[model samples]
Target: MNLNIFRKQNVKTYLGEDIKFSRTLSAFDLIAMGVGAVIGTGIFILPGTVAATTAGPGVSLSFLVAAMICALAGMCYAEFASAIPVAGSAYSYGNIIYGEFTGWLMGWALILEYMLAVATVAAGWSSYFASFIKPFGLSLPKAISGPFDPKNGVYFDLVAVVVVVLIALLLAQGMKSSIKINNFAVILKIAIILIFIFVGLQFIKPSNYKPFLPYHMSGVIKGATTVFFAFLGFDVVSSSAAEVKKPQKNMPLGIIGTLAVAVVLYMGVSIVLTGMVNYTDLNVANPVAFALQYVHQNWVAELLSLGAMVGMATMMLTMIYSSSRLIYAMARDGLLPHHFSKFDKKHNSPQISLFVVTVVIALGSAFFSVNQLTNLVSFGTLFAFTLVSFGILRLRKRTDISNTGFKVPGYPVVPIISGLFCIFMMCQLNKDVFIMAAIWLVIGAIIYLVYGYHHSQLENKNSKAEEA
Candidate 1:
């Protein structure tokens, strides 16, 4: 009943509550899931925004810059995920290495990022849906297409809602089915993107690359932060660490391999895009489709639209998967509740956690703008990455358990530099993002006091009850 009580727990007790997801994933499946979640949105969608607003032809460089920062974070995640082999991505590591209070806030920050991220991807999905619907002379109403908030000039987004519902159904079924679907989705989208790049390459004009950093010095920073969205899916690889057959070896391969593949594809597609058409002419939202149109490959644009629709669906699918697992880790440790953290015995999935995340994502997708949601996703990810980088240093000093696989080669220096890079990117997001982040942290603290603290495992409640 005391409001000012504090409790703490160690890793062993926390791991006891998990439903044993140890047999469901392989290195390939883990990598495929990362590819499935990350591949679609950034390359196919964000290049245009970078091209139009930041770097123009130099958006390719932006992709590389973002990838560099992620490369560091990815390695840190692979190391942590492999050692712990748990479902909670940064949140679990933060708790074990940093402390519970820090971990809770990280978990809370993640809810906004992933929830809005799903909504953002759903909005992107909606645009592609509208594009596909257009050929039949069918167009959805503006109000149905999106909410006219009037404040920002929009309120509801129907297409995003539809996408969220369909994906949630798939996710609620189980991780195995979700992984299988993601494998197919990732392959199909990659094939489609490759088609865009290969065909678009033959038509490159060279002039488009002339004034690359169109926005000047700051453009690189702008493009770097914007393109970070493309690099988003890498963390999902780490989230499934608990399920991997060989967490130590497989986690790194999946995280590193998936990110390497994505960055290459992003750069290739960016080059083909600007080469085929001047970056200035690209639609920030619909660049790839438009680039195909420039080469008289309008039919491919149609296919791109369809691929994109499917791509975003899978991204939302995996993102929701990651979110549920992270939250489940929190809840099983008494941060939320047994209900939110429970797993399905038959399906071997976090059904309750997944369902809660799905509802929040669906509602957000139905209401928010794409631009508004993108910042939300980016803001928290940078902070989480910074924590993971710092966790590497702390975990090393605190635990004598030598990591068996994917160690950060340089120890303190690698993580220190990575943490710095993460900070650099975090500062690049609009100043408003920091304000939103602060408010969320305050709310998380309030919940920790009123709920998580009392329910905590550290109190040895059963022993005390027997004595009473």
Candidate 2:
């Protein structure tokens, strides 16, 4: 087989291919999907944990920091999705501008992200659901309530698996049904967040914010790194470009609009949370509900927990949906088995790929603890975001393609800054995550060299007599 590291995919031809998707998602549905994905455990759970442990009252500033990074990266995504207007999100963008090798690796990293994201959020949902029902004495035993935690000795989280299976079945029905559920879930999540912010606001004590930066700038930055996971779901919107109506216009709208809404919601929650309860006491698993307990709003607290479980459901569904597309896209390119790309004629959904994703997510959620999976999710996303930031620069240098949709305002500066910010936040992550990511990338490399390199559709096309 010939070595072709720099072989680029043709976006126009790829878009023109017979591969069909039910293009039914409007900009609002895309935004709802993005919102559903972004506003999950990160908001309902992480704010209090980060505030108590790292940033204190200044955790709101951490949201601001992460939002800045997301805004820059989101702009780059908007440009790429608009210009390419295909499935596979960053992986597709990288393939068009960088090469097959880079694209393969990006898709591999994305698979890591989406899988871990579903697993982590599912586990989080289980814990919150358990907490919500414990007062009524309907909670499961320790053996089933949580996944395997070496310290706690719990094993096989039953709720997590059940949720993943249900979501998988829903996705198999098609995008239309899954997205309708997502829209409803998004509205519930936003309403719950608003309820928390407004209701908690009346109980805010000014003294709680006396030393807003109690943990200092380093702590704030650390908090920003931890909470960056909250801003991940918007990119999943881009992954659905092929199924979205008017991809060129609505893709940017969904990406940017989702980020704006997420930032405001996160910041508002952080302020109200710290003010309602002392930051030091907000480190529990159900932080929002824990804070609400102080104000004697047990019913609202229960509702918040219910909303969190629902929010995580949307996140899980979107992540699984996006990751399955990555598999389908790569399989269609012959990097994986062709059957993985096979879509149902009636539903236009990749049933086989969705099944594979569901199985992996269920297994991961059953065994891995949320803390163990969160770092992997964060590392993979930051790595993909870095590549996307760099890909924008490479795409702009190309003169062959007709560029359309939203363009990044500052060209090289925006992407350069976005790339640097991604790197900095990545550097702040635990070293173990880097090691794990490196190991995953190495495995992907091995598979590509042993199989994908030889069997790639592009290689086959290059050898065809007509092409010659």
Compare the candidates by TM-score and give the number of the best one.
Answer: 2
Report the lDDT of model 2 for residue 408. Answer: 93
Question: Candidate 2, residues 214-266: lDDT per residue as tens digits?
Answer: 98999999888888878987899999999988888999999999999999999
How close is every model to the real structure, measured as TM-score?
A: 0.90, 0.93
| Candidate 1 lDDT, 1-468, residue by residue in tens | 554332234555444544376467888887778887787756776887678767888888888988888899898998888777777888778777777778877778887777778877787788778878887999876767874475654668888887888888887778778788888888888888888887887899988788877788678777887787678768877878777787788889999988888888899988888888887788656788777776799888888877777778777888888888887888777879868877788888878888898888888778766675477677788889898998888777756345677788788899999999889878877778888778878888999988987776544632443344
Clashing pairs in 1: 147-154, 147-155, 147-156, 148-154, 148-155, 149-154, 149-155
lDDT of each: 0.79, 0.86
Compared with the true structure, model 2 gives a TM-score of 0.93
Name the weakest run of 10 consecutive residues (lDDT summed) in model 2: 459-468
In terms of lDDT, the best-performing candidate is 2
Superposition-based RMSD of candidate 2 using all C-alpha atoms, in angstroms: 2.5
